[model samples]
Target: MSKPIRNSTEMTDITRLEQANAMMRLVNQALARNDLAALAALGFCHPHIGELKQQGGFRSSSIAQNTRMITRLRKVGDTHAQ
Candidate 1:
């Protein structure tokens, strides 16, 4: 059997996953609000978003993961896009 992930690595992965999920939600909300400027501004600075915007195609799961991060950030008022 494969070795299990250490506790620290697992926690880090969970944190990153949560952040990605929140970002996705924020992107969706911004789109719904017709705030492309805000979306562009936000995505411009994000590593995954920037890469995706440049490439023009990304996996659904990757998009979903980032959306979740945006959503959570919005909920917590961490970004102005909301």
Candidate 2:
């Protein structure tokens, strides 16, 4: 009953976290590849990156995380390089 409901809620949170991580990975890969089209499709652009860079707190954490992710992706080699 209540135990099962709690488990269900926890599972939902895990799923949401996984989804967010996947989205971040995709965004990082796109940036590494310099895939403007993919970035545009994901609603990311120079201004968005700039905003993230300028913000502090959670926003800053998010930006730092994303920047690291992109750097890692770039190091792995660009799959979409022109």
Candidate 3:
């Protein structure tokens, strides 16, 4: 069973995960449009750019997926804390 968050750091991690997902959405959008300028502005370096291009396309992580991940992580944390 999952437990309630015991500290602020856990909440911060969730927030960071959401933020990273949002950035990924932006990156995907830029890639879709072939917007090199936008990709560069978003800080995609040469290696990452080539890799993303090779991958062709990817689905951005959905909110439901993140929620499930958070739930799973909390359950693991609860187990470890016991």
Question: Of the pair 1 and 2, which is ahead by lDDT?
Answer: 1
Which of candidates 1 and 3 is the stronger one according to TM-score?
Answer: 3
Better of 2 and 3 by TM-score: 3
Tell me each candidate's TM-score.
0.46, 0.49, 0.64
Off by over 4 Å in 2: 1-6, 50-82
Best by TM-score: 3
**Considering lDDT, where higher is better, how would the candidates rank from best to worst?**
3, 1, 2
**Segments in model 3 whose C-alpha atoms lie over 4 Å from true places:** 1-6, 57-64, 70-82
Which regions of candidate 1 are displaced past 4 Å?
Answer: 1-6, 44-82
Q: Give per-residue CA lDDT, model 2, range 10-73, as digits (tens).
A: 4455555556667776766665666667767877777875553344213336645655665555
Clashes of each: 21, 0, 0
Please name the candidate that would achieve the greatest lDDT relative to the true structure: 3
- C-alpha root-mean-square deviation, candidate 3: 5.2
lDDT by residue for model 3 (51-72), tens: 8888864454464577667777
